[model samples]
Target: MTKQSRLIFRNKIFFRLWMAQSGSSLGDWFNHVALAATTLSLTQSPTAMGLVLLCRDLPQVTLSFLAGPLLDRFSKRLMMYISDLVRALVAIVFIWAALEQQMWAFYTGSVLMGIASSVFGPARNATIPGVVAEKDITEANSWTVATSGVLSVVGAAFGGLVSTVVQPAIAFAVNAFSYIWSAAWILITKWKEVTREQDKEESSSYFAELREGFTLLKENRIIMALICTSVAFAIMSGPYFVMIPVLGDLIYNLGGIGIGLLYVADGLAFILSASLVGRVVGNNVTSAHRWYGWGFVIQAAFFVAFAFSTNVWAGMIFIFLSQLGAGILLTLGMTILQMTVSPEVRGRIFAIDHTVDTGVKQLSLLISGPAISLLGSPIVGMIVGVIGGFAGISWWYVSNRERKNVSQTSEPYQI
Candidate 1:
């Protein structure tokens, strides 16, 4: 590795957290591929497939209001451990559900996994800044984003291959093991116990605390813009989950292999964008925001191209290009959020981000399901592509309008 690449690992705690992130992320994709394939196979209905996706997303939408305050009031480290442990146990149950062909059980397991993940994700995001210097935020986020991307490729391909050749039950078992590995890392890492006196002072009634998170969202113009743009991008990309499997099975007729290849392309792009673009935008909020703007434009263009492509390989290339944009937006957004926020409220902010991203996508998937049935995937893609195009334009306008205000009002973040 290059000297710059080694910099993030210099913080041993950050390194440990990265390892934990790697294990859980790998398991996430493993479960995703296996569960998606299993759901489609069991029900053989597009609506059922969408419903399965809904099960995994619904918790983030509904529970984030509560999860936000809980994360802020408690130990993020403890939360991570508990979340991974629960997910690990749930993965075992997933295997049983798949084996017994109990569709309801499978959905229940997925819902449980989603609940665990909702807590884990915000906790992980909130924890990063606590362990690393401000100077290293970009490098640290790059490492995390790249790691997630690489593992996604591995997990998706492995899950598809195993599900196709051996069995999906095997994939679930692998996921179960990965969660255990993640929890083990968390167990070993020594973390400072956050004193609850500060929390107790800040705490109010549950609804009051929840409203405080929303208050922060309203006050922070930049964060609000980020959330809006993120929602737009998420809605535009919602068809991807539904289309990948449907296109693989119905259009390309390559089944799991086709879906796996597309996922690989997306993952490769994510790795490249996060590692390369991440460093280029380092420590400069303006630069990061600019990249985010361009990323949306790129995604809008590619979404259209992907929809039009007939050949599977050609479509994969389009998917790769689109996800590159996605990677840039996602990584930079996280970095910016971390650098900008006070640690006390970071968890709640990230929780809101998660809620908006997942909730909007959930709503989009609901629409995509029926849209695909009536209008077909390509037409649906075209429609979302147009919406993305408009969103990109709007983001540019909003970003420019807010830029002067944010720069003047923001406090300097120190290492």
Candidate 2:
């Protein structure tokens, strides 16, 4: 592809949307690191750190179902703009509370920000089809994901650096400004509202719409399998994030900077993987499935390697590999969904997928803390990696068999 063709932001709407998302994602990383640090500073308990994370993910667990139907019913652009505004307000509150040394304010702000993310998740996915050409979907996703990953790495490193030099409250204020800037970009974009096609047969009730989304997933075996695999992967991967700080503190003795470095390593790897996806992913469902399977296997093996590492450099290397695998899987999965699913149902389906994925992560996070406490971080990590590897291999075998069966059945009708 030519350089001009590769430029995702050349399209006016996409440029604006990407800018907004990039800025917001950068601020989110800062907010995430700051929250973890603040909790550690105040309570100095791993359990407390886990609880703070739980608070952030709790909305996804509880309200993800609602996100789909709401995205379907409302204008996605409007929803995203409103979510940004809400997050901006919450960030301001966080800044104020952090400055005042009030822990409750930070906690409350985190919860609100979580709610905002819960709403924005489905809307953001659903808006992509509206912004880019169908053929360029994979490339568009890759560019967006790659940019976000780089920004996340930068933001995490910056947060850590800022925390060491400046106060946490000041870091929070900078985060608040980032949110406002992102919101302003979205407002400037003037993205057109996506109107749902008129369908007299479909019900307007939220429960009915949610049921429809679930039914669609049930009917599409491939999509169902993909989602199940995603849940399994989340369960296997979630503990690493929850336990990373503990590993840093107890094992590496690197403190906040170590945590930040871990995030940066993963993000950098993710960006590198995403940047290559367009050339790798082809125009067929089978190709998508193949990429997804390989990605999972690579991720599982990396996780296993990561669990066995003692040195910080070794840890970073393995973590980077794992993130590269994850980026590939995400790119292919999203592209397949966007290409195969009807736009009308895309919002709800994407939301359901995200909800299931996040719910699994939440469950994993809840269990991980205790599991680590009981087994120690290294052993717990090893167990998760082993399980994840088995799951990936099993998924690959079953999915390949299913694909062959599908192809064989269709072969009889070929001219």
How would you encode candidate 1's per-residue C-alpha lDDT over 1-415 as one tens digit per residue? 7634676557888888888888878878788888888988899986787687778888888887579878888889999999999999999998998899989987787789889989998898888888887877877888887887898878777777898899889999989999999999999998674422444566577567778889988987767877888888889866877887777667888887888788888889988987777568877766776777788888778877887777789889998998888787777778878877777787788898888888888788778777888998778888877877777787777777776655687755221
Top-TM-score candidate index: 1
Tell me the lDDT of model 2 at 87.
88
Off by over 4 Å in 2: 1-5, 40-50, 190-194, 197-203, 246-249, 252-261, 282-284, 376-382, 394-415
Q: TM-score each candidate.
A: 0.89, 0.88
**Tens-digit lDDT track of model 2 for 243-263:** 667756667788877776777
Q: Using lDDT as the measure, which candidate wins?
A: 1
